[model samples]
Target: MRLSNLIPSIPANVVACLEVQGIRTDTDLLFSTTTFDIYKRLPAGTATLEELTEYTTIAAEIGAAPGMSGHELLLLENTYGDVQLRTGNAELDGLLRGLDGRWIIELSGDKGSGKSTVALNLLINHLASNLEDTALWIDTTCDFSPERATQFLDATQTLPSTLERLQVSLAFDIDTIQGILETLSRPNDPRARPRFLVIDTITPLLGPLLSAVSAQGHAIMTDFMRQLQTFAQASGTAVFVINNSSRKGRDTPERKPALGPSFALLTDTTLWLEAKNDNNTEDSTEDNTVHTMQILKSRSAPIGGCCTFRIHGNVICPT
Candidate 1:
């Protein structure tokens, strides 16, 4: 079943792939056995990957020598690298950033909270990091504004040319957004890795759509969210969603409500952004901002902290 001899020109990642997939021996069955699942299960553990180069080199050589199909040659090259994946965000840098693969980051708070601004800030960060990177902004309420793009960078007091590079597919509904994400998540497509994805709010995907179609609409929204999760997981891109805080009971304490149970279950991190009580507009003057932060949940680290931020000119600046 060994393909290494036949694909002697392969890279180590390929050779190691074949060997680990039980393809180390010569046989017709090797082709059948070395399927998608076999390659998917290939361990990318540090120690195991260290020796991939030597083996992949041998296999790739054979693939290159002559009669291999382009598709077959592609597989050899595609599967043969030590890919250092990136999250394309500064706040969630290092291992915690893109590790979750299909991470859902939710920003939830009452009205006037800077949740949307913070999400936009990340969107800018994604663009600043890579000009080629794309971002999707799903505007359920028609609130997405290019004019407001400068607001997220307000602290800088100046807008840069790169800000215009924040590519977006403005989706007015859940289904529209769902369709766009599906196209972006297809494997082997260069457009799959957008810099950031923003769901302005999940309510439009749930309530409004559900009311019109009843239970069926609710089910469709649910499926759409699942698809979002799948897209995030496979592409290793960031998923950001703004959520409206649930209403509090009349007699209930002003304490904030936990986000939807399902949100906590699916997102890698959940952050709450709420402004402090405005004692006076001019009195606080710590750059005239008073946004507070709390890590509602974090799988990568201790989900805890407080951060003060404000929109100086148009952007959210950490104070």
Candidate 2:
């Protein structure tokens, strides 16, 4: 809806000022720009915080104004109503209760730990489902394989139409990555809005600078993560960020994510994946390699619980 229509009571001059700032619609005002930013764009002495808050409240109400009652929301929660997509692995699905669009899920693991494989599976499942949702994948590792995705599609017998719904982009640096995310955060077309966003190995883009304790790097990282979180909350898009793990010590058993504790704390849910056996030899074979996914943190469910799954020909399956 147009901004003018949503806030008809606002002065025409103020609305025109907002329009001049490229915020002509409610979606643009709410998702594309911040209130303080918008206020700065308006004419002097014409904008007020109270007015901006009112406009935001109205926009939010309009977005969720489907007349859903408290009891109905409760009923939906009982039926896993918030689940937007499934991983197809029963045990993993049970642990995650399916992917919720409202939360950010972080998948961190050691090298060759099937983080990309699991993310690709989720994208495939999201598009293959009956919902009208679409997905956006940002590949930073340059390892996203369409051929492997095709393997998944062929396995599930999904038509070519499903593949068409998945949009993919590659970003090699922090600036490019942030640009892609910011663009997705305020999509111009409603149909083009993504329901799922996947960033493969986010740590690689920011890890080096962060490790060196670069203040500028930290500032950029902070802005990027904050924008990402805001986008997830405002758009209700399920986000999956792949992070690489760092071995703590040669003798120590613990491994930490490359993004470190600060980044981990920002996510709503964190899943850490590791190979089950450290003693497994090179001839262990693909089928013999079992990975365990443990919930390091979760806001809506019990933590410390884990599930085991294996990767077989691009498919993540419960063992």
lDDT of 1: 0.57
lDDT of 1 by residue, 119-143 (tens): 7766676566556666677777778
Q: After superposition, how far is residue 159 of candidate 2 from its true place, in Å?
A: 2.1
Q: Give the 10-residue window scoring lowest on summed lDDT in candidate 2.
A: 76-85
Tell me the spans in candidate 1 whose CA falls farther than 4 Å from its real position.
Answer: 1-102, 151-159, 190-192, 208-221, 253-259, 279-281, 284-287
Among residues 3 or more apart in sequence or in different chains, the pairs in candidate 2 whose N, CA or C atoms overlap within 3 Å are none
lDDT of 1 at 242: 82
TM-score per candidate, chains pooled: 0.61, 0.70
Q: Rate the local accuracy (lDDT) of all candidates.
A: 0.57, 0.74
Off by over 4 Å in 2: 1-83, 188-191, 211-213, 250-253, 278-284
Q: Give me the displacement of residue 301 in model 1, in angstroms.
A: 2.7
